[model samples]
Target: MAVAGVLVLARSVRMTTKFTSALDIPVEFVTKNVKLRGKLHHITEKGLEVEHIPISIPLITSIQRKWQSKGLLLVKLAGVEWAPSGMAWLQQELKPKQMIWFQLLGREELALECLVLVNKGRFLSVCLNEEILRQGLGRTVPIKGLPHDSHLHWKLHRRLLRAELKALKKHKGIWQEESYYERLRDRISSNRVVQVNSP
Candidate 1:
């Protein structure tokens, strides 16, 4: 289905005129629909879950400009609500001390939205997204609700796609699990003995 809508980003940073549907509105819509500025509340391999309220405003809590880990950098957020018990599985995998900042990109599906993690004044847009995908944290799905006219946006999109390809080629993260499944299938087939009839 084709639907056209305009979503305004925070501080009037950018405007988007494309959206898929109401169920899966893009980051553009999220910014316009919800509050633009908010604390970076939760982080996981799946996607960052941010609770934006009318009063919540984005606050920068750290000045440490260093990389903490591969494909990840931490930035503290003050006065942010914690993720609920339903997200315990995801929380367990996260480092509570390392609360980073992210920008909503768009929606991938019904419950999941795409985000870009920023670190050291640079956007780890694809790395963070793909790292989660490669590690079997989440599925790599197509996203809509964005303007294709922006060169920068299109560039980021291409980078994300390339990261996924790299993950698949190197058998990193989720690809490793895929390989295991393949091996299991081979073993199962090998154990099956075919009946032979004498000619």
Candidate 2:
């Protein structure tokens, strides 16, 4: 095939990253723009743990600061205060029902409580059960661990770790950003496994 022919035939493919909803928001729309309405439940080293509880004027004032819900999903996404562990500790962190936009979809709504796994300061990987990934996104997959977590999960089998990073970066920037969402978008777009020109 001629070079021009190949160029004309080529199509940019973008791999949409879906969070396995260790909580409830759908992963398909993770990076897409969406809206969410709910009470902010938790913010830990993990991810946002929000509740479907309808907002009330009085309740809003009561839960100004992030508070733990005395329920099964006790801890949502842990905040920098409790867990200033790695790079995520640097995260300004979102507050309950504060209504902040996210790297994922714009949806402020959160599902059940899930652990937000910060991966190599590149991508936000949530540690979810295999079922959520399968059911939420509707697919059969391999290695449920986040890209960065893969190293720990697989015991840092060097070659394997390199392999995962190589593949994961091809998808998007999950960690390490200037904290500017646009730069984050640029890095994810240019450095992803599957690339596409999105609208």
Candidate 3:
């Protein structure tokens, strides 16, 4: 099509469309502009893969510090300070076979960078990554090639930084009063456990 003395390609036209969720909030009226809803199926080196979205979906975002592949995601969610390596815990918390929602922060190659939230009953949703960092389960790191809107992106960056600070202060996640070598050891050890446990 031609408009204002310029020709628009069909490919460009197709890319402009946005996704709206029927399972969650409406498109225009919602505070979060871009959203995706699906089931949590698996995890990748960098993020989570979601299903039932009718498209290729991977949800991940930039962290303040990246996790060195522990091979297994070690989560200490219970009252204790540490927990074993098991996918069952995550699956239970995320609730398998149910539709979950992701608020897209931005886009990266092959997936949408999103805030994965779990619903705490009616109208309340929790960002899993943020909560993880806040509770000292993980750390955050920034990645390159984020969105060009500095204002919006900076806001997200600040939020991640704040979460990291909280983790550091409480010595949560990988920062729990361990030496560098020991932290590395823990990461590797957890992975070994996962490998032995995987069927």
Candidate 4:
């Protein structure tokens, strides 16, 4: 889950194009997708619950300059309604004072018409439409041509982390760099946790 969260970062889309179905009907889509460090809050028969995902220390510091103190959360999602019950469910289940980042992963399926991705489980990746992404954020991500983690150095580091996380989970391996990670991890508790809930 953690690895998926990390891998899913960066390579994301920004809202620009108008969604259309095979019939050329206008459709909605979630603007942006993100997966940050958070904890599971609850679980229902149909959905999983989670909260308080931490961001990379560097990311927050770097993006904080322009984005508001409580960064954008409410975004336009095409073909998907903003479910108040869903948000309220989150508020009730998630731990009080828990802080984490929620990444908007793209639609569940590929087509001109889109459904905002919203998973009810240990982790919830909100499906937001392009309007949401464009409204809250100034950047735009084309649907294609994202820079993949294929460079030699990036691959090597990815491999190393993959191996380490595997070993750590398997047998509780020596956390050689616990102190290093501690220093490197962001202290979201100290900073404001932004929940962008606007369209």
TM, every model: 0.44, 0.22, 0.52, 0.22
Of candidates 3 and 1, the better by lDDT: 3
**lDDT tens digits, residues 59-156, model 1?**
31121113111122222111111224213534664554433334444333443333434343354333355444444344444444345565645665
Of the two candidates 1 and 2, the one with more favorable TM-score, higher being better, is 1
Q: What local lDDT does model 2 show for residue 77?
A: 22
Off by over 4 Å in 3: 1-33, 53-92, 143-145, 179-199
For 97-155, candidate 4 gives per-residue lDDT tens digits of: 34433333233333221223444467765433322222221122222211243353244
Question: Which stretches in model 2 have alpha-carbon errors above 4 Å?
Answer: 1-28, 31-33, 52-97, 103-199
Pitting candidate 1 against candidate 2, the one with the higher lDDT is 1
lDDT of 4: 0.33
Question: Which pairs clash (backbone N, Cα, C closer than 3 Å) in model 3?
Answer: 63-140, 63-141, 63-142, 64-140, 64-141, 65-140, 65-141, 136-173
- For residues 1-199, what per-residue lDDT tens digits would candidate 2 score against the true structure? 6987655433111111122232444455343323223345555544455433322345343553244233212223211112233224223433335432222312233323222333334454433222122122111222222343444334423423343344244432232232356677878877664545443
**Cα shift from native, residue 138, model 3 (Å):** 2.5
lDDT of 1: 0.41
Pick the TM-score winner. Answer: 3
In the range 56-169, model 3's lDDT, one tens digit per residue, is 212211220143121211111111122232233354566544566666553433445555667897989876656666766555655233454557656766776687678777
* Candidates sorted by TM-score, best first: 3, 1, 2, 4
